[model samples]
Target: MNKPNKAPNNKEFPLTRETWRYIKRRQKELDDAFLSKAKWLPNDNARLSALLIERGELINEFPETFKWWKHKADDRARIIDEYIDLLHFLAGMDGMPAALFTMDGGYSRIMFEAETDKWRRLSNDYVLEQLLDYSPNREYPVQSACKVVALATHIMGRLGFTDGDILVAYDAKNAENFKRIAEGY
Candidate 1:
């Protein structure tokens, strides 16, 4: 829905919540295309694998800050890319609908469901800090990856990523994903 032909306007999407709605609309295309079976449940092994793969990709962008003078912000874009990649890893699990606004107190915590029609919250940051870290609590299924996506939006806010950037980038990725699925990628 981003209009790249015109000037960038963060106000177009305005809030993280609005951006999420946009994301979910596009995500449904993938869910429908890929998991069109009765009880289209997300596989635990697949989720964990995707999570770790994305997390490792994020880590690979790390550069040792041997000295304060040696630090570079150029990787900011790469970091954000990796963060979004992490969110995409959890995109397809059934749970609560996306929120109309950003989630509060989401720092270091992951939101998921542990039972039918039930929502439970947990944090993935603790496990992420460990090397070869992986969390296998499929019971703590990501009710909706939008929560995790919101966490990425929060990070983007910190790195000066405006609503426009997120909205545009997300739409762009969504289209690319659709193409990949169409091609059986």
Candidate 2:
């Protein structure tokens, strides 16, 4: 069977529902196969904390003005890295199905606003934990997991991330992680 090509970027938004679903599915599969395989409470807590921290770092990338002397890391790449890390934690949860997330507007508002975004990220972590806590004790914490995935996708959009950037960055990071693992790092 042949599949038709997708239309190019929307210029305004970087994601599509189908693409978002695919990325989430891919992340879930990879996490299930690797990161979540030997789950631990400490690791879960680390993921949650890392996500909150990433959100904070991501905000820093947008400075009020750029200094000619201040050579900084690529902000876009940094955001993507943090975003993927957050996805990894969400993936580790292993709860949510891909269908729960999409590129549309139903997210909990994570725009360019600093104050609101910070608070939102905090609230999100709280909600994620609550979801996992209420879920039945099992290998996959489905309830909290899916909600997190949905929220993360929304965050991607709010952070001005694109589907192309995610696809590329994710592959690169995944490959690097594998290589590092193979090298016993």
Against the hidden reference, what TM-scores do the models get? 0.56, 0.51
Each model's lDDT comes to 0.47, 0.47
lDDT of 2: 0.47
Best by lDDT: 2
Model 2 misplaced regions, further than 4 Å? 1-7, 36-46, 65-74, 96-161
- Model 2 / residue 169 / CA error / Å: 1.5
Tens-digit lDDT track of model 2 for 44-109 = 444545545554454444332223356665476666776666555554443424323332222223
lDDT of candidate model 1 versus the reference: 0.47
lDDT of 1 by residue, 62-121 (tens): 443212355654476676577656555554433334322333223123321221112113
Give the clashing pairs for model 1: 110-122
